[model samples]
Target: MDEMPALDKMIIYLDQLAISQIFKIKTGTYPSEAPHHAFWTEVTNLLQQGVLLQQVLCPASDIHRDESMVFTRGDELTLTHEMLGGDTSFRSSSEIEGDQVWAYLRGFVSGKEPILDLSVDSILDGHRNEWLSRLHISAAMDWTGIAKDVRDRREMSADNMVPLYERWRADPKTSFKSVLKTELESFGSSRVTAYLHFAEMARRGLGSIPNQFVE
Candidate 1:
């Protein structure tokens, strides 16, 4: 059961890169006197205190945990997420989109405006608000081999996007709308196809219980 966090509470969103920096500091790869190390360490400590005091909400999402696939065994980011992410998470974009789309479809049938809850509270899932529930699984097994793939894809995209970007910028007539209609359609289709393929892989990886997660 999720508690609607105090409306007055500030939101702090830490993406994976920030988490990785903190992880490095934790492992002492960053020297103690390093400015980044000290900065991230202080930031993390303050965020932790803020959460404990309910002065802030550092919400996370499924992608954060999933992206941790890039980290191998003995290199768990789960604990860092537990400490800062605080169990409050946004439902995945797909799930939220599915619900909104379904509601929109229902509006056509009922001939009424779609009644959708767009508030942050509506999307949050506080899996365990109690103090004890934040304890993360310590041991990690089986690196998912995504780090290399991510690096390769990044490098590939960097190489590919430059010319497209230069071409677009050079053409005064080029517009986002035109790009969306012409180029983005294929990418969007591929995105959905890739999501389905990955979902299937996830199902197979989980074996018997697709919804259940074991850290």
Candidate 2:
């Protein structure tokens, strides 16, 4: 079983990306050199805005009301070059690209080996306490529900089970048509068609899943 749901993983990735961007904006530098205090300050400031806070956090359900801390009080935030993207020359600058962020996100949800050390204790968890409070809430939403359905209902075979569209969509370097065609040939028409249909639903809005099923 997938330990962390795909949609939840995606939300966490997006939240982390937003946090990194906000950190860069406030400090006039990327997160690599940012202090823990500065990072938390931006998070606190962001939470004060009602709409944007909702957009940024995207809490799914009542679990957001939970007051539990995701990271222990003694936990110290470390700033390291490795965590900040020193491994690959794909991005020479400190700024984390959208494509790189998405690739890491995809790798995370798919259980692929970590490329950038995204362990919960790392910078990704700076908002951990707040995010966990709202984590359960967002997981119950329609978008996440669709992801759950896809995970549960997708075929077991490697040919049909791999989320070709999702993986390709997350990677900027990959060609969608090429991947889809390859998947179609390997998985056959019936299975590939279902994947296409699900991808379409995911595109327009995952909230549309119920309507698509009804029709």
Candidate 3:
């Protein structure tokens, strides 16, 4: 027997949980009303942990006010990378590039579900958030390297730098002072000491060490 690819497993799990229950719960219908079975709770938990991705089903619903639609039906949905404790990475259907996964999804929902017509090709699209997520991850890794360099230079005593390391994490606005303060506190170094040390290193034409030093 061929083993299922990891991506396929993820899609199957998401399809089962997202499609099956989201419709009923969001629609406020009794068919999906059991608190224990509510899918959003699980979704919320995943989102909090940055383990689940949320794609908006588009062509927004236009249901008759009188009808009780179980889920928000749409022709398209977006795929995004949910970051733990940070913003989400949004990707369009076009971004998803797995033919086997698409085929599996089509087969999985072809005649079984009313709202999902997997036959309709789903396009993977790109969003600003996707770029933002990448940028955030990049900056975070870079800052971690810088912090570790500082720690190694000063021989500071700290178990893990994550608390202060998070200062470089993505935010709407970037503030050098905020980042400096966080690094100072985390490394147990004063602002002058840290700045002078880094400045001297820069003056000496010493470029940032490779990230592998910390990782």
Candidates arranged by TM-score, highest first: 1, 3, 2
Best-fitting candidate, measured by TM-score? 1
lDDT of 3 at 23: 44
Worst 10 residues of 2 by lDDT: 73-82
Tens-digit lDDT track for model 3 on 58-87?
A: 211111110112213421111122232123
**Candidate structures ordered by lDDT, highest first:** 1, 2, 3
Q: In candidate 2, what are the lDDT values of residues 30-106, reduced to their tens digit?
A: 55555665665555465434222323333211121111112121011111111221111122212343335556668
TM-scores of the models, in the order given:
0.58, 0.19, 0.20
Candidate 1 residues 107-136, lDDT tens each? 979999999987666777763343434454
User: Which residue pairs clash within candidate 2?
Assistant: 60-137, 60-138, 61-137, 64-133
Which regions in candidate 2 have their CA more than 4 angstroms from the true location?
Answer: 1-16, 28-48, 51-56, 59-175, 181-215
Q: Candidate 3: what lDDT?
A: 0.38
Better of 1 and 3 by TM-score: 1
